[model samples]
Target: MMTRRGVQWISSAADDPEECREHWALDPRSPHALPAGRYFDVVAVGQRVGLETFDQLQRHGMPLGPVMADRASEQVGFFLPTWAKSPFDRMVRQETADRAPEYRYLGENSVVVVPGPMPLAGDRYIWLRAPMRRPEASLPRIAALAAMFVAASSVVARADRYGREQSAASVDGGATHAH
Candidate 1:
């Protein structure tokens, strides 16, 4: 936090000067103030959380941008959230690998912490990064996800066509099953 001319501020306080300058100054609702910054101009399913983020933008008089449903192989079940092959799982693992331990899962002796299996209401959550503040800095991951939708869509389409062809061939042959 900084106080300049008696106006105290709690914004991006990242020790990296440039990072603080780029991300800390903007709130979830601020018009993306960077006239230029490294960013992918696309999005994927997990980025759907932007619905909440953008709502904040609208509430604060900020302009909203285009949002499209992405179709990446990587996003097949991430946001829509099916089990086993969720992209969110792999993404979380990868992030954990790249990050220092958050200890979100650990107790003082490294014991597992649990709020138990009880479902939390609202079924909603947000990923929060700290220090230099922003409601979400998840944009980079979203951009990367836009690439995976293609692979998922390709496999789905091919399976659909194969199923259709098999059905046609089966009908043409007058196949019969007695069970």
Candidate 2:
């Protein structure tokens, strides 16, 4: 449970909490575009993979900062500490060479749309995990995320390989029957 102040700090562009509240009052359903690489960086992954990783994180009792989901885009964004941007980027590049899951690391010069503090009806962006007031208090480290991504990717890759093999076998069986 994040405090209102915490929500304001993370979701609002305004420095003042009161101003943030006023902005929210104007249109609670509307999302706000907050610049990345300032307070935190965003790592976005496919909704399916992200949800799987999120569940694993919870089961392992790992720290999770702030996570937002874009229903329309089918992506989940995990907020990391600003310092993690560079290292995470490097890791992603390396991992991608070996067929990593599709993801985007939004750091400096990137803008992310943050949902309103409270979950309102008809909001496209929703928070899976709210930010803590301390910012880093609940944030997971880059190493942890990297490991989870690798694990998830392996599972997906194996599933894909299995599916392909099954299809090939089915085709071969059908051809044999025809003969």
Candidate 3:
């Protein structure tokens, strides 16, 4: 569970905390834009890939910080420390250069819309993994996250290929030959 102080710290990532607060006050379910690469940088991945990576990380006992899921975009954002932007970007570029699992790194000159601390009805963005105590300390390092992503993407790709092959085989097998 996130404490009030944790929420305040997260909101402070915005350029204007007051503006963010005002927006949330007007519509609690509304998402507010916060500048990336300040308090943290966000690595956005497809929902499936992200979930797989997250599961792998958890299974490996790696610490996870705040993670948000955007249903409208079908993306999951993993928050990393501010200093991780450059390394994470490099890793993403290297890992995803001509790959199925695409990654979007929101660093400097980027904006990320995040939901309120507590999710509400009709919220398009919600926390899949909420910030825990000492959120910053709980963030995963670039190497750990990158490795997990690579492994997870491989698993997802293999599964997708297998599914496609099965469907194709079923379709072909259903056809009758003239003989």
Write model 1 residue lDDT over 4-47, tens digit each, in one string. 21111121121243553344244322211211112112223333
Q: Which lDDT value does model 2 have at 105? A: 87
Q: Each model's TM-score, in the order given?
A: 0.25, 0.78, 0.82
Q: Which stretches of candidate 3 lie over 4 Å from their true place?
A: 25-27, 90-101, 137-140, 174-179
| Model 1 weakest 10-residue run by lDDT | 110-119
Question: Distance (Å) between predicted and true CA of 18, model 1?
Answer: 33
What TM-score does model 2 achieve against the real structure?
A: 0.78
TM-score: model 3 vs. ground truth: 0.82
2 or 3, which is superior by TM-score? 3
| Model 1 residue 122 CA deviation in Å | 14
Write the residue-wise lDDT of candidate 3 on 1-179 in tens digits. Answer: 34666667777888888787777667656777899977878889998999899888888888677888898888889888877866766675577647535688787889998877677645799887766543653324677788788878888898999898778778999554454
Q: Pull out the clashing pairs in model 2.
A: none
Q: CA shift at 47, candidate 3, in angstroms?
A: 0.8
Q: How close is candidate 1 to the true structure, as a TM-score?
A: 0.25
**Going through the candidates in order, what is the number of backbone clashes in each?**
10, 0, 0
Per-residue error at 146 for model 3, in Å? Answer: 0.8
67-179 per-residue lDDT for model 2 (tens digits): 88888998889888878866776776565656556788898889898877666545688878876574663324676676677677667677889888788879888443333
- Candidate 2: deviation at residue 179, Å? 20
